[model samples]
Target: MKSSRKGLEICCGITATFLIVVALVFTTLWFTTFKPKEPEITAYPVGLEDINVFSIFFVRNITLNMTITINNHRNVGSFEFKNATAYVNYRGGVVAEVPIGQNLVPARGKLNTTTSADLMVGKIITNPVFFDDVAAGSLNLTATAALHGKVRLFEFVKIRATALSTCDISFSIASRNVQSTCKSKIKL
Candidate 1:
């Protein structure tokens, strides 16, 4: 009976040691290979598709095209984004909202999606700041985009994360030139 008890104790010890080793291995792997990371997002203005302004008081119509790029820097994870919308704001008011469809970005990959914003004449003319910016020869606008999705790691571990991007656009009405600066953030 004593020998049997010793054997049982030895088995338990071995099992505990094995579990500790396995846990250590997994912890190391997680820190080195499977950790979550934020994606880099950037926005570029493709061009002004159409711009029509009647004097400094009225904007007949305006259309702006833009490209959004999502870069996944992780070596072991992929991002699956759901349907989202991008908004264009003048001063503090939203002028355009564009839908960005679902997208999948593979590991260590980049995705470029294109969207267009059509500014309504009524929305622009109602804002008194629009006239001031137009009279100054430039239109200052802000473009915002949010991507909500899951990051799949090792085909099993999925983490919910949201990537938000905002870009400040300065458009020259006379030269048709666009200058933009963008910033991005991620929430996990």
Candidate 2:
């Protein structure tokens, strides 16, 4: 009876190992066969194409206007973005970082959203040189947005994509004319 029990334990161990190996192989094949597309993201200052609010500085208050456009390029499932944040930079100095809650962008369609950052002119304009530059007008701004999201395949398989976008904006306070260009990338 002791020998029989030892044999039964060995058999169970071997069976478990075989099942684990099979499961690993199946998972490998599944990932190699299935591919999920990354979502497309674009960001820019709102209404820059025509006439729009780029940045307004009045007294000690400053308001920056921007928009982020997200497109779920895949046909399968909706892309959900969490912990989205936007940063505005002036000459490599980060002025503000705005928190944009969670968003679920529909597949094949697009989500056009707007976010604004209110900054204090006194705090950001610390040095006299920077203040002089702003007083002269023609401020160049660089804005960046990062989002963490995931796309699911076959209901259970989830693919994570980190979307990043950078925008270069040129706004003339004196001229009231603004122009910007942005490029987006996704890391899977």
Candidate 3:
């Protein structure tokens, strides 16, 4: 009986030690493997909020509305966007630069923002090819956006990334319609 009791005591101690070591290893791995993931952001033209054209003068003022969607996946923490802007590019040239403003995106959540751009349609007419593209029923343009923000990881690790993306956009000049295509390479 005495021998059996001692052997049992030894087994219990070894088991406890093994369990504690396993727990320690797991805890270390948990924190070490955890990191902040880059947030997902996308922007696309939605429609024309306002369009006014004077037939006699051929001057036009247009308000283009775009939808900016952000997805902060879990483990990425929170994002506090300072400023966002989109530059309308035509054939590798910048025609218009619009500030989209700032907002916040929660962790593991999604945010939708509406950005507007005031455009001088008459000025765009200066480019014959641009006018042709618009008259063709689909005005194809590239939207290059810069997002300046800070990412908070577990409310502790804070890092800022100036992310920029080039996205293809299409608008129906005949109607107040817009379509968004996929984004190109994102630069940091």
TM-score of each: 0.80, 0.63, 0.67
- Evaluate model 2: give its lDDT: 0.68
Candidate 3 steric clashes: 0
Per-model RMSD to reference:
2.9, 6.3, 6.4
lDDT (10s digit) by residue, model 2, range 109-172: 7888878776555545664466566678766777787778886565676778777777787877
Q: Over the stretch 24-88, how does candidate 1's per-residue lDDT look in tens digits?
A: 99999888887766667777777562454554245555666778888887647888989998888
Q: Score each candidate by Cα lDDT.
A: 0.80, 0.68, 0.68
The TM-score-based order of candidates, best leading, equals: 1, 3, 2
Weakest lDDT window of 10 consecutive positions for candidate 2: 48-57
Q: Between the candidate structures 2 and 3, which one is better when assessed by TM-score? A: 3
